[model samples]
Target: MIKQIPVLDCCTLSGYKEDELLVDHLADYLHKHSSLAFPHRHNFYHMVLFTSGGGAHAIDFTRFEVRPMHMYFMVPGQVHTWEFEGEVNGYVINFSREFFQSLLLRPDFLNGFSFLNGIAQDGAFQVPAHMEEEMTAFFERIYEQVNRVKPLQKDLVSVMLLYVFMRMEQQLSPAEKHKFPVYNYTLLRNFQKLIEQHFTNLRLPKDYADLLYITPNHLNALCKEYLGMQAGEVIRNRILLEAKRLLVSQDMTISEISDELSFNDNSYFTKFFKKLVGMTPEEFRKNKA
Candidate 1:
């Protein structure tokens, strides 16, 4: 167990590849980058469509079985590790955050797909049987263009990728698409951003509410409406998540981890972890180990 999780970036993983992008058959990709079998996080957005596999992989702390035609989308800074039983093959597309930004008018175009969101469970999905042939063909086309770059190769790739995302979106039920109003959804995302940035130092939802220029009650209402949790709960959940991520590595002691998260003390942090997780930090680490 290393003291810190490895955060991988595009260039380091891309190697001889250019253009801030990596496209390859998963089996071939893994053969060359076998070190990735260990737990790690990536700086670039990552996705994989497993055509055949067994066993399971954990994204963050939640485990999902490797399945045929299943797609996993990962955002930057999320820890992922895989345990495989036998052969596992698929198409893995890893690209820098800017891979699509410069090509599209909307800077946050990728976020429109819920599967691209940082949540562990939301990032994993199984494509329908009918769509597998078309999706695999799309992946193949992107792979083919890698070696035979045309004048506007990347532009073509971006269009194909966006179409793939749109097809995925089309599968969602109407109810899932319109759960939160546009304004409230934007506000909720803003609130989440603030929490992500300040969760270590700011413990209260009002602190985030102030940053968002919204009242605490209003912020709470948006969170409750969109996330099914109170604003405070959302903030606490972020802090707890960071704590769990930190605990995964062995470098930090309980006291050090508590201090790192701005906790009042080791005992308080232990109680908080137990109250929600049903196990002490040490116990959780041991069990996972």
Candidate 2:
């Protein structure tokens, strides 16, 4: 039997049966939810604006250092865990996919923000020194808004969060923004989403390109331009990430993990893991331990 890592949802964190959003101070949330400081996944969008802290956290196997005025975002299904040095305090918001539907006209308003688009590297950033005052106030407002009892409170909170996103988006350089046009970002993000779903069954770039209705060359070009890797490499990276994720389960042996990831055989899987990772699966697991 496999002992799966925990997947936390809004209800589990807020203790509200029908809650779709959670807004709280980081210190308070951490105090009540310290048990979740292990490897886990969140079922909703999660973001944190750190005002003060030291240490590190991992999102989708990538470790990021925790520091003052830094923020990070996580989309649903990404695995993350927190490790703080001491007395971390900031703001955290977790909202469902539908949290903005009733308040916004565009169904895809949230997708326009690069920081919230589900990539681990793109989502974490340090708040600029000039914007720190305004940025921190936005989070404080969100913390206060959630405590108020009023009509359309969720809608109001949604708008405030949108403002926060807008200001943060301004901090990104024009070169970064111009590199990924809307059409290209849509295709690239969709391709990644498909890989998340079909990586085990479909390992080729052409397979994903066909589904996205673009030529294989075009797919690879977009990936190279934006992600600095070929489309196939992106797919393989997702597969490798899942392999690492599965290895987190001690009950699952290397053979079982290989089978779970739909590799043809244990030996091939071992070779694949070692080639890209520079270590055997067992070695990677033991090292992480």
Candidate 3:
């Protein structure tokens, strides 16, 4: 049996209050809605700042320790669950992709952010102590604007959100800033978009290369140069992530998961998973349990 995970819509989850965006105090939001304790997927983007807390947050297949002065980012389709000790206080912001694209006039605008672009090794990080107050203030302003009945509401939210991202960009060191050149960034974005579309059926580098109008070698070289990994690793990692999600979050049998992922057979999927994860699917599922 596959345990069904809830796919939450931003507007509905936020009480259908402010259209496609929701900004609120984390503790207050949790207080009102207790069901968030369960693992869930959001159809929109999610970012939360932790002013105080100690716990664990699992994003995809990795569990990250929670700490103060930290931020976690989650793009659509990623599975996440969290447990915090004592009083966890901070701000939570959620917005849909359509909402962002409408305001920015660019469908792939989020590719520029390391957090959303899969360029960040882990989706959570600790903010420098000196920047905590400033980050909090930005979230506060966004919360206020979100709740206010004002003209040009969407534009106002977009400006405030862009300010936050801009401030984050400014904090990046010169080396980090130059990590991805403009052309490479475009390739990365296209590659990621293609993966989301075809990861289920197409797992080969040549297949993706054909889609991107590049030769397989060129695609592999670009991925290695920018992401520090071959294109195949990127594809395998994504499939592995989804496999883990199904194994742990859902109650699917190993054979069922293998079939669902379109593997040649159960044995091939098991071998492939163990090679990368250092454990068979059954072992991984047992460990999670």
Highest TM-score: give the candidate number: 2
Query: How much lDDT does candidate 3 score?
Result: 0.80
Candidate 2 lDDT at 76 equals 83
- In model 3, which regions exceed 4 Å deviation? 1-3, 16-19, 118-122, 148-152, 172-178, 249-251
Q: Once superposed on the true structure, which residue ranges of model 1 sit more than 4 Å away at CA?
A: 1-3, 104-109, 148-152, 172-175
- Tens-place lDDT per residue, model 3, 50-168, is 88878888788577877877888888878788878888889988888777776677777776766776433445777777798889888888888777655547887888898887677
Give a tens-digit lDDT track for model 2, residues 1-289. Answer: 6665677878778743358888889999988987774688888999999999899998988989999998999988788877789889999999888888888889878877877766789888888899999888878888877865544377788889888888878777333667668688789878877887799999999999999999999999998987789998998888998898888767789989988899989999999999999999999989876
What TM-score, over all chains together, does every model reach? 0.87, 0.89, 0.86
- Give each model's whole-structure lDDT: 0.82, 0.84, 0.80
Error of 1 at 81 (Å): 1.0
True-vs-predicted CA distance for residue 136, candidate 1, Å: 1.4
Ranking by TM-score: 2, 1, 3
Candidate number achieving the greatest lDDT relative to the actual structure: 2
Candidate 2 runs further than 4 Å off: 1-3, 15-17, 104-109, 150-152, 173-178
Distance from true location, Cα of 216 in model 1, Å: 3.1
- The digit string of per-residue lDDT tens for model 1 on 1-289 reads 3266678888877743464888889999889888763578888998899988788988898899998998888999898888877899999988899888768888877866767767787788789888999999989988887745654477778788778888887775222566666677778767766777788899888888888888999998877776789988888878888888888777789988998899899999999999889999999988766
